[model samples]
Target: MPPGITTFAADAPTLSAANTGFMLICSALVMVMTPALAFFYGGMVRVKSTLNMLMMSFISLGIVTILWVLYGFSLAFGTDIGSFIGWSSDFAGLSGIGVTQLWDGYTIPVYVFAVFQLMFAVLTPALISGALADRVKFTSWALFITLWVTVVYFPVAHWVWGAGGWLYELGVIDFAGGTAVHINAGAAALGVILVIGKRVGFKKDPMRPHSLPLVMLGAGLLWFGWFGFNAGSWLGNDDGVGAVMFVNTQVATAAAMLAWLGYEKLRHGSFTTLGAASGAVAGLVAITPSGGAVSPLGAIAVGAIAGVLCAMAVGLKYRFGYDDSLDVVGVHLVGGVAGSLLVGLFATGGVQSDAKGLFYGGGLEQLGKQAVGVFAVLAYSLVVSAVLALILDKTIGMRVEEDDEVSGIDQVEHAETAYDFSGAGGGLSTRSTPPGPGTSPAPTNKKVDA
Candidate 1:
């Protein structure tokens, strides 16, 4: 018996078909988010490094999926082994688990729950890839994710979601994963970039995104998939909480997008498509933990603040000199911190949890708890990630060669290019020269238009 979990209901093991169907669909939606992330990060890098960026996100679906099925799930959700971690091998290989078995309090099959959570495990590490883009070796990036998730992510998941986990027991309200996913990944991004250093042309070069249209497409896919990410965290669709979360997610994201654009207009003297996309993601991060606890109006507030703050936060890398290529620390870390902390101010008792926030007369107690959870995860993830990065850097070499980086990670690492301009005369002029002395004329089969 886990310490904080109470057996209020009998172990009848009855399943709800509706909830099972809902979670299955949500799981698929969340699974798509990883590839969606690949596109998002892919289009944000220079043309040369696009495929490597996409692969960084794509590979996590493979690596984390295997780790999760084998023991990652068990280590995260297994019986409590103290509050910091779960029993590692208790459910290794998912052994001794029977079909038609229901999760303790939920109406869905335990397997359904496991698969749904697996999507989260997949996306979290991939989120850090954006910060380290354009400079890391493919093999080193793969190895880093495998180890980082094993050491940092699994234990944090336990502390936040596992029954006997300290933060769970302390009544900290993380409706989904603002703390676990966003802040954890964001801080880890900062830590690794610190250890691995910066790209060759860190501040001097103009590292503009090669494909803004692709970035928009990726952002759109992320928006579509995020509905599942937030609402599905409820674990069942039969409840009204899912509905509330769904609405809040939409409203917050919309508000954040607008707020981000407005801020950009003021600071940069014009609105930009990139600001809109980044703002949307900022809102998503902010509302992940608080959507279920706040009203539509509250959601708007959360989104608006995240939009403005993350817009500002993205500039910090330039100001502080750490080169977070994609602003992971700014958008995710800052937005996540904003959302988690605001839950202390705006949470209402009528929502998912009975905990109220400062504005609702709950005092500053919950706010303190939220801060504790935020900083604890931040500090732990930062230190551990930095240490892991240092170890990997020292031993197997974490970065690409300068020549490889200058040429492009795609050609050097994957031996494939994302776009082949070769068919288009290497992206140069399409015109052909007229027949001349001692010169072979262009193929007559191909017509040359004047």
Candidate 2:
């Protein structure tokens, strides 16, 4: 075992059944978020590209799960090599580990810990799919995420969570994955979008969400799952830290949703379901890193700030000319940065760890650390994602052809559609006939003419 990991004697009660059961449940909850993400992004895109959007998030579960077991887990949580990465083969194939052996500090089985972290590895890259919606090829996207998690995510995970990681050593206060997951994925989304270029008629065309109800459902699932994402990080249910994080998570998300609605009423002159969903997500992302450190009041401040800031930030793509199709950059990146930084200002050091923020008389020390963590992850992910996208664009191609894009990615790529309206009765249909040469496709907004 790596240093500081103590294996219990054969007779000792090595596992805490409560913590193990809790973590297992938490892992399952986090796993659901990816599909929920598919629904979330699926509802936001044009009707033609909905299934492709859902597929983007769904495929990650298949791809990352295999890779994580093979070597991804080893590279992420194995013995530290230089504070930048874990040993690539130490835990390869989960070798040399037994069932009774416990993970380093947690009382749960090692495999349990591995699976919990695997959920994170799976979701992080999937988060980027929202920004590249409607244009990317499924195979190329799969390839990109495979490479991205291997090169970008694994090392970063080590940096933030691995033993002797530089950021961990520096006392950067990322209780969960403010930097490793959200900022990393968000920056990567921006990078890939920059290289892949805009959708055919990004600003000119109307690309409103096809199903706000679906988006709301997805948002509800995400909110439900996030309790595990945040509180489960504590690894044990015995600690009061998990309870604090749970309460903070709830209040922060509620505050953020309200804050976003408030902002929308003022800026857009209307309250929108999309706004509420987006606001809740922003709050969830912001609180992921800081919930373990901040108070309920602090969580409100963080959520409110993230809601307003992300609300405004989503429009930056228009001004800057980047096609972040579903506003991943605005919500995840901005929210992650807001939460990570705010921890330095609001951390009370009483809930989980003994790290106080500036407002708690801790000065600017924690804030500076947070900034370094954020910038490092952002710069690294951006550059790496851009390079991967450019390479894919040069080779097998990153985007669909113009005709395929206009026709629909689902039809061209997956040979299917999300919704069909061509049945005899006024009910849903599964059959979708591809448009023939020189024939126009059906109007996306039209229901079956009953």
Candidate 3:
């Protein structure tokens, strides 16, 4: 919720019911994105581990919510401690803060702000799950995130958004969470995948998505919910900044989807639905940090560039051989970085702040600051996340048994499968459909796993 405007309690504006109500609704919208993400990642895996893929994201809702209530909020947004972290007894256990107390100088209640930011904290680690899909034990994955968020997510959030934090003070403009959420999650994904090694057959198997329709559905929901994610970061409707952000969000996403389709058609000779869905998400990520500062046209330029860049980046795994099953590294990390840097080029001197971009007479200074935020978050998350993954790997174990992984994580780990066919006319019947006239019976295309 860093709106590029930091305020103190002494300067606080009286609570406005309009702003309070808007933020509450925005919180709910942001909450839906986690389950939507579960569906998106779930549909990307083979049928055998579909439930596992889904649970990887669903578990974050439970873990992070409780953590945020405990000490997570305080560590993230409390009074700054030497510009490195934040702390205050009032925020610990979410105690002593009155329900009607305003947050900073905003027109919303402290509770409203905490809950809104809670959604962001919950979604950050969930983004990492896509990279660690089939092979890890569910218990280990859960534990990994518990540690990852504590060591990596909280500190980075403070650095980027918390008052008096280094990046915040340095004027690294992230309207939403390109650095704290996307880059942090993406870098953490890379770190863990490095320690855990490749999925059993990284290069040998196709591992295509099992359900394109489900993926599209999830992507649509994410697109709908992201309006809250980006626009709501302003924390109020007191100005046209949020309105411009909303318009930028829409145009950027449309431009990115079209750009991705064009690139996919040229490169692979087909405009696949997966490319469309992935491209939409790339645009969303790219615009999250910069949308408030750029015009709609600037947003389109940012999205188009990110669409092409991320589309090309998905192949880097093949060249270097890392098993990022859902292309988290390619889309989120690269997209986050792209959106962040583009800010320095597209930001106007009007919206959000008086800071102009490179194209608008601003120099390379802002770009350099953005690089610092991007690099700091990336390096810290990558190194610490790898260390945490290695510790878990050496201790109680992080990977499932080879037999269990090679089989199916769903039935082995959860004792459940994504589908139960005994009720569906006893699964699929081998009997052929009756022929029409003299035409031959149509074939049943049986789907296979990687």
Candidate 4:
């Protein structure tokens, strides 16, 4: 067993097996968050490309599933090469991992850990697709994800989580993934958006959601699945993990929901359900990194701060002229940063069995370490993602044909629509005129079957 891992020796075998089983369930729970993400993003886009948006998430599920089996797992968690990346020697090629412990000190099945981590790998890049909705070709995104995961995502995951990783050695506390998952995905999303450029007719267009109910449904699922996400980080069921993460998740989400609504009431003159839903997600993202590290009060602060920052960041695209269609950069990138940095100050001792933050009198050194880690992730993700995006854009093209875009991606890309109410008494004849200048209809009703 790992040196610091303490348990009754007589209970070791049973508890370890139970923890493995629990984590398997947890990993499956986390995977559901991606489809949930599909709904959340699908409901926010123009009617023309709703199915296309969901396809982005679906595409990741297939592509990353394959890649994770091939080398994605090894790259992230395999034996360290140089404190920068992992060697591929442990490439089990789907069989390399099993219900056996690989790390020297850990007790859970190595495969359980690998699969749980793989869900995260699959979803992080998918989370970025919200920024370039309705424009990028499906082929381009597929190729881009292939390359980006290899060059950008895998190495960063190694640097943070893998044994002998630099950040892990530096005593940086991720608990979950403020830097690796949320922040890395967020920064990479920004870089790709910049390279891909804005979606057609953004800001001036009235790109309202086609279905508010879908968004709500997605939010509900995410909330349900997140319990596993935050708690599962422990790799086991224990008092410490249950105590800190449960409370942290609850309070942070609540605080963020309230903050987002409060801000909307002040700015837009009404409290919107959309804002409340969005805020809840914002809170979840912010708390992800710090959930296992902080107190209830600290969780509140993190959620409130992230809520305000993301609410403001969503408007940045309009000012800066990038078309992050569903606010990936605004919510994930900004919220990730808020949570990560706050953990530098608010982390209480004993979440991970060691470590505290500057606010708890651990001094400015820990905070500075966090700043370095954050900047490093942002810079690396930005540079690598930009290069990969440009390469894919040049090779097979990125944007769909102009005609296909204007006609709608569902018809052009998927050959189906979400709603097939055609020929109904209240449907065909009531077909409203297509929207015009300064008016973009909500996303077309099209479910992504994948």
Cα lDDT tens digits, model 4, 313-423, are 889988988888888889988988888888778888767645678889777777777787788999999888988888877878888887787778878878877666656
Clashes of 3: 0
lDDT of 2 at 444: 62
Model 3 misplacement above 4 A: 3-11, 429-450
Comparison by lDDT, 2 against 4, better one: 2
lDDT of 2 at 445: 51
Tell me the whole-model lDDT of each prediction, alpha carbons only: 0.90, 0.90, 0.90, 0.81
lDDT (0-100) at residue 159 of candidate 1?
90
Worst 10-residue lDDT window, candidate 4:
1-10
lDDT of 2 by residue, 217-251 (tens): 99999999999999898887886888898999999
Give the C-alpha lDDT of model 4. 0.81
TM-score, every prediction? 0.94, 0.93, 0.94, 0.90
Predicted candidate 1 versus true structure: per-residue lDDT over 50-131, tens digit per residue: 9999999999999999998888998888888888888745367877677887777777877888888999999999999999
Flag clash pairs in model 2: none
lDDT of 1 at 29: 91
How many steric clashes between backbone atoms does each model show?
Answer: 0, 0, 0, 9
